[model samples]
Target: MLLGIFIAASSAGWAIAQGAALRVPDVPYEPTPHNVVAQMLRLAQVREGDVVYDLGCGDGRIVIAAVRERGTRGVCVDIDPQRIRESRANAAAAAVAERIRFLEQDLFTTEIREATVVMLFLWPEVNLKLRPKLWRELRPGTRVVSYVHDMGDWKPQRTMTVQGRYGPRPLYLWTIGSAPDR
Candidate 1:
């Protein structure tokens, strides 16, 4: 029974991703757990000097938190215009509007070369879709943090289950050039 439950839970994210794969839209706007948000920032080792990018940013919570907690500057990119507007408002509410750029742009087309740390709460397929982009665009040593999905075939440098809003959830971290890009 335990194994069955485990298998079901593990496959659910992928099933959802496949359902949404045709569009590859932003991972459903379920906000990352607040605890997980800080954990993601910490895992990425965010610093004031780091230029971060939160792809598929929803409500801009992650970027706002990064600026508020890490004193870092970042850009929030979400394909949804509504999310972009909400992010801007959230940034203002958090008093970090000037430190962040809100772009209502497709994640795939956005330029992420300037980022030293990138955060995501996207799906497995989206991560796979973005993996090559991350390798081709991000500079060596750039850190990438994904809340749940693992970039398929590119094993993460680190993976751990951390406390979240409901329970423990896996957070994956990979540093660009940690190994020669295959």
Candidate 2:
């Protein structure tokens, strides 16, 4: 999970003194630990030629790691511009910026159909809300990995416990179209 405070705003948007409306993020940023990031990539079985999308990517660690360690191209999506900047800087430092695209927009609105693997470290409700989009957009056999959250009623292909910053955390993996539609 990436770390940051997100102020929830109306769908219509919130206006400041400048009269410009801002679309607030649905979740806060709490970066996934480095160890968990490694496990997520392992669970997803990312490899070369794979396109990895990390929704709510904080500091772009997951995508950066995949690009560096697994030779995969990646996209980092975040609703907050600050987080996007941090991701870009981190990716640049990791020397994988050229292989990663950073998008400063809502994850739900981002185009992810091309992703061969999707990584998420979001809230439980957000994960549930994102399920249909994953099912509808991702092609068959596309792997979806989530850290510390499960899509309710959607059985995962695999689940593992990994040592995290706090303690052991659960990671989940689901291959698109592998199980019955929920």
Candidate 3:
């Protein structure tokens, strides 16, 4: 019955019944508009030699874009293997497969300390949950940019509003050292 499906479980309770080990706590996929994506990368100042990590990377657009636009390398992490496969296909189509590493793993546990820039478009609660990891792991001056949701309580260094196909959307940016230590 429901055994085959990995029901979205809460962080507090991980109910394992039939061995479908999947825990996705983020929001549904909503691709950041291309214009917004450009603005996000620009805000982070992604340049050549930079390593960008996209947490909960849906289709790997951010990673592909970073490599395609600025010759930077990128790592995209997603819990969904289908998304990882799609990411690989998209990277190949974008002609930047060599510059991207696609991983089908949990966003909260993946090691991204080497990232110079991290992009996100997750839900508000997930944003808050990820704040500590970003603060502790990312190096000082490492740029973290979010498409819509923001890290709660930890203020962004800069915030901007962009007009997309769906109208105005808020974007947030935070540098690692700007926030007080946990």
C-alpha RMSD in Å of predicted model 1 compared with the true structure: 10.4
Which candidate has the highest lDDT of all? 2
Candidate 1 per-residue C-alpha lDDT over 1-182 given as tens digits, one digit per residue, 9 for 90 to 100? 99999998878876666442324465778788787888888888898888889999989999899899889999999876668888999999999999998877889999999999999888888888888899999998999999878887788889989887678889999999855466
lDDT of each: 0.86, 0.88, 0.85
Residue 104, candidate 3: C-alpha displacement in angstroms: 0.2
**Every model: Cα RMSD to truth:** 10.4, 6.9, 5.3
In model 1, the worst 10-residue window by lDDT is 17-26
Please give the ranking of all candidate structures by lDDT, highest first, separated by commas. 2, 1, 3
What's the C-alpha lDDT at position 110 in model 1?
95
The sequence of per-residue lDDT tens digits that candidate 2 reaches over residues 1-182 is 12222343342244553333156678777889988898898889899999999999978899999999999999999877778888999988888899999888888899999999999999999999999999888999999999999999999989999988899889999999855477
Of candidates 3 and 1, the better by lDDT: 1
TM-score of each: 0.83, 0.87, 0.85
**Stretch of 10 with least lDDT, candidate 3:** 11-20
Stronger candidate by TM-score (1 vs 3): 3
Top candidate by TM-score: 2
Candidate 1 structure, TM-score to reference = 0.83
